[model samples]
Target: MVNSKIQAAEENLIHVYNRFPIALEYGDGMYLYDTEGKEYLDFAAGFAVCGLGYNNKELNEALKAQIDKICHISNLYYHVNCGEAAKELNRISGMDRVFFTNSGSEANEGALKAARRYAYTKKTGRFEFIAMEHSFHGRSFGAVSVTGHEAYREPFEPVLPGVRFAEFNNLDSVKALVNEKTCAIILEPLQGEGGIHPAKQEFMEGIRKICDENGILMICDEVQCGMGRTGSMFAWQDFGVKPDILTMAKAIGNGIPVGAFAMTQEVADFSLKPGDHGATYGGNPLSCAAVKKVIEIFEREDIVGHVKKTAPYLEKRLEEVAGEFEFVTGRRGKGFMQGLVFSRPVSEINLKTIEEGLLVIQAQGNVIRFLPPLIAEEKHIDEMIEKLRRALRKLQ
Candidate 1:
């Protein structure tokens, strides 16, 4: 029987998520408990947002202490948590200044504004942006303009014009799209929602050269593949290419709502002046404290190194599972952000997996995305593999 309280929530709430039809009451490490107390292995990790895992002791303590102190304060004033968080971000990202926001889309919005403002200052007649086909930035109006998926853009037509699309991992496509009218070339180093495709090294280097030649800014959207998700603090570090502007969220504040955009000192000073842009709860103490602790734990626990060690094991196990199924096409992605592409449509498989108590995310192009927490242990990996095997066997 469905809980009356949960049913009330379903009735009252807007249907944005179209969730798994189960009410998650709590989670610990890589497992979640439904309202009925059924435990499920969570490979989705709140859609890749929870990096450190749920109910982490360090994170809980930090948040509790901050709650006792202060939850929020406007960005108009100086805040200690904001300063500390910014310092930690700068250290981690190698960027100069950070603009805080509440979500990944907002961070992308800020980056877009910065690109335009930079062009405006130069009077370069460069108002257009070049994005990639099958790329997902965010849902905000500015972000949607650069997002390449037609379905997401169709309903919200006439979204800020002059946005162009190029083929992802295809340097020639980007070169052809970029010209005098381009203000920036924005893309993810690893495409997340577009079925976990990692940008080739040559492709990234080619784009860097093209952007430099065209005098256009390069922005890397690391919202999903960043923050130790790809066994590194930022995915660009893996490619050895640095963007003029970087946008990130997801694992930044762990489960807390926080996002950030960073740029070089020159770009930040010239493009993003004070009073140019701001968010109400952007740099609130609560979010900042959470981010600070998240970074601290990532470093102290060597979470990235742990992911590097564990990812290969998970990948090998997934390969073995795929070997058993004729319909399994291939595995893609890096570190913990892996995807299993199937020969057949995966919607039925996803539903069956959910029924068997495993949580996975469905991505475009018949792929099942796996984004487990960075702190997931060997036992968690084994559990996920066993559940997936059971689900696949039943499908056969």
Candidate 2:
């Protein structure tokens, strides 16, 4: 039976998303409550955005205080939280300058624009970008242009031109795509929607070297794998390689709609100046306040350290669970961003898991992607496994 709220939402909303049947009312810690007050262990973390989990006192208080003070002062002038948030992001991400956006897609859009602007400024005539096959960037025109999935790009034909796709983790394929007109090579250090594929260390190093040799910008879309989800500030940090431009979102604001694309000092010096790019609500005080508080909580609580400690346990349990399920072929991913590869489509299993009061999501390649909150502990992992086992048993 459909609830009134869900029915109303469906009526009012565009038919873009195939939303889950659960209509959540609130959440606490690692659990979410539906309108009927059924408790559900949240493993999806709202598609890897809500890192701090639900009803965080510190995060809530920060937003309340900011609401009393100011929300939107526009980008025409400076604000307190914006600069502080950018500084903290820079301190953690190793990038020099940042331009805030409202979502991950916008961050990628800004990054692509910055890359083009840098080439334009350099008079290099480099206008092309090399992106990875099976990589997910975003849905916007600029972002979708470089996105490798045919389904994402086919509907929006003639997206930004001069983009080529290379097989992920294949240095030779990436090299074959590079040319004089290649301005940037963009990839996710750990792909989220593309089946939890992590870039090989050699592949990362080789891309960095190629970019260095060819004067092409290396853009890392850390939208899903960044913000300590990989037990590092950015997934690229894990590879010991740095991108010329870094695009991030998802967990940065801990559920608030905020994202940022940062650049090296050299790229900043040459790209997106005074009138080049801007956003009306991008760096507004409200979103920056959220970003500021989230980072503060991460540092004070050592969220990354917690993830480093807990990830191995999660991985071990997933391995055990996969071993128990005949259809589950294997597992992959880093830190809390793990996935179990199944021999068949995960849609029915995901629905069954939700019915079993465990919230998990799906990815490409018939995989069940698990992006639990960064604050998830061993007990949470155990509970998730138990519930998941029930779902798998019923399905089998």
Candidate 3:
């Protein structure tokens, strides 16, 4: 049964999302409490956005302090935290310039624009892009255009022109799509919505070589797999192949609704100028404060190191869970981003897990994607697996 809060929300808001019945009230540590005060062990971590977890005292204090100082000041003037945030992002990402956006979709949009603008500036007459198959970028017009999912692009019939789909982790497929008009290749190093498939090291190096040979820009969409989610500062760092353009969001601000697209010095010099792209609330003081604090916390606490230490345990526990379930076919992913493949539709199983006091989410290919908080420990993994086991038993 839906609670009063959920009912009220449904009545007022557009029915775009088929939301769950439970109305989340608040969170403490890795657990979320509903309106009726039922506790749930969160494995989704708000779709991997809450890296620091819920109600973190230090993060909260940083946000509260920002509120006390000032919140929204337009980008016309400089704010205290924006430059600091950008510097930290560049320092961590190894990108030369950063442009902040409100969400991953916008970051991707800016990235697409940057890639095209780079070609335009160079007078290369190359505007086409090659994106990976089964990849999910975002829902915006340009992001959806190169998304590579026909269902997503079908309704939006006329997407950005000159874009082609390529088989992910297949260098030949990407090479086949490249031409004189091909300006960029965009892919997620570790695909999140496409079933947690990590790109092979050789495949990554091959793409870099192809881009270098063809003079095509490489863009890595790290919106889901970045910011310590993959036990690296960015997923691409795992492969040691740097991209000309990189997009990041999700855990960047630890839940502050901010995203960014960064580029190397070469790309920055040739791409999107002041008149080409602008976001009004993109780098607002409030969001920058969150970004600044999140990065500072990540550095001070060595969150990436923690993920590296804890990920093996997570993988081991998930393997056990997969072995226990007859329907579960396999387990795959990197660090905190893991998935369990099932033979049957996982929608019912997801609902059942929630009933068993756990929260998880699904990806394509009947995948039960596990994007637990970076703060998750071995104990949390044990509890998550046990709760999931209970849910699976109920289904049986």
State which candidate has the highest lDDT. 2
Compared with the true structure, all predictions reach lDDT values of 0.91, 0.94, 0.93
For residues 1-396, write the lDDT of model 2, one tens digit per residue: 789999999999999997888799999999999999999999999999999999999899999999999999868889988999999999999999999999999999999999999999999999999999989999989999988899999988978889999999999999999999999999999999999998999999999999999999999999999999999978999889999999999899988999999999999999998988888899899999999889899999999999999999999999998899899999999999999999978999988999899999999899999999999999999999999999999988
Residue 139, candidate 2: C-alpha displacement in angstroms: 0.7
> Between the candidate structures 1 and 2, which one is better when assessed by lDDT?
2
**Clash pairs for candidate 1:** none
Model 1 CA deviation exceeding 4 Å by range = 1-3
List the pairs of residues colliding in candidate 3. none
Q: Compared with the true structure, what per-residue lDDT tens digits does model 3 show for residues 275-377?
A: 8999998988889989988989888999999999999999999999889878999999999999999999999998899999999999999999999889999
**Native RMSD of candidate 2 (Å):** 0.7
Give lDDT tens digits, candidate 1, residues 1-396.
Answer: 777767898899998876667888999988889988998888999889999888998899999999999998867789999999999998999889898999999999999999999998888989999999989999999998888899989999989899999999888888888778999999999998988899999999988998888899999999999999998889999889999999999899988999999999878867977788999999899999999999999999999999999999989988988888999988988999999999898988888888889999988899999999888888988988888988999878
TM-score of 1: 0.98
TM-scores, one per candidate = 0.98, 0.99, 0.99
